[model samples]
Target: MPTLTIRNLDDRLKQRLRLRAAQHGWSMEQEARVILAQVLETPAQNDGAAWLQRVRQRFQGVAGDDWQPSDRREGTERELPHFDP
Candidate 1:
């Protein structure tokens, strides 16, 4: 892991970060990290349909129609097993 030194950071921006960190109950450093990760994070695709299309294009004519299960779709819930204590 490398250390990042933000030199000559603006007072207002730093104060805002402090407030945000307090709101989220995080340290300033943790808040900065979360902000950085969120800003730099690249979403696979905003539109799920577009993402599926891209996957299909990448695997175009590869083989086997049964590779994708018809039962599989996003947000399908399964019941969790109850544990006896």
Candidate 2:
């Protein structure tokens, strides 16, 4: 088994940790261990694509209004055709 030591902890932080451990029915050491384990674990990416898709959909709706199309057409300025009667 490996042991870790944390030094220079502030009194207020220690008190808060003790209170939180008591509230959760765990010792301070155990609480810290569990928290550290959770912090080090990789978060699941199951919903990443869905979240990206939703963000893209939202931006797509707003993108049209945020940019204007260029005025030039076919390598020249656009001109209306004249009609003869």
Candidate 3:
């Protein structure tokens, strides 16, 4: 068993923690332990690029040439003016 000491806890925060613990039918220490356990046990997705790539790969075959804007000839393409100033 390990011992943990928390210091400088505000009175208002301690009161809120006590209320939350009571709501869940747990002591303040037990509630804190449960929260710590849950937070530590969960795995986080840290790679945004990898997630985006996976999503793009999943829906890769859904679109076709018929859905492209160039496929539909509505009018002549006008290029936007490039401002250098």
lDDT of 1 by residue, 1-85 (tens): 9999998999999999999999999899999999889867956476798889999999998988568766666688878989999
TM-score of each: 0.49, 0.54, 0.54
- Stretches of candidate 3 above 4 Å error? 45-85
- How does each model score on lDDT? 0.89, 0.85, 0.85
**lDDT digits (tens) for residues 1-85 of candidate 3:** 9899999999998898899999999999998898889988876555687788888999898866567455455676789999998
RMSD of 3: 4.8
Give model 3's clash tally: 0
Lowest-lDDT window of 10 residues in candidate 2? Answer: 38-47
Positional deviation of residue 36's Cα in model 3 after best superposition, in angstroms = 0.5
lDDT of 1 at 29: 95
On TM-score, who's better, 1 or 2?
Answer: 2
Which residue pairs show collisions in model 2? none
Candidate 1: misplaced stretches above 4 Å? 43-85
Ranking of all candidate structures by their lDDT, best first:
1, 3, 2
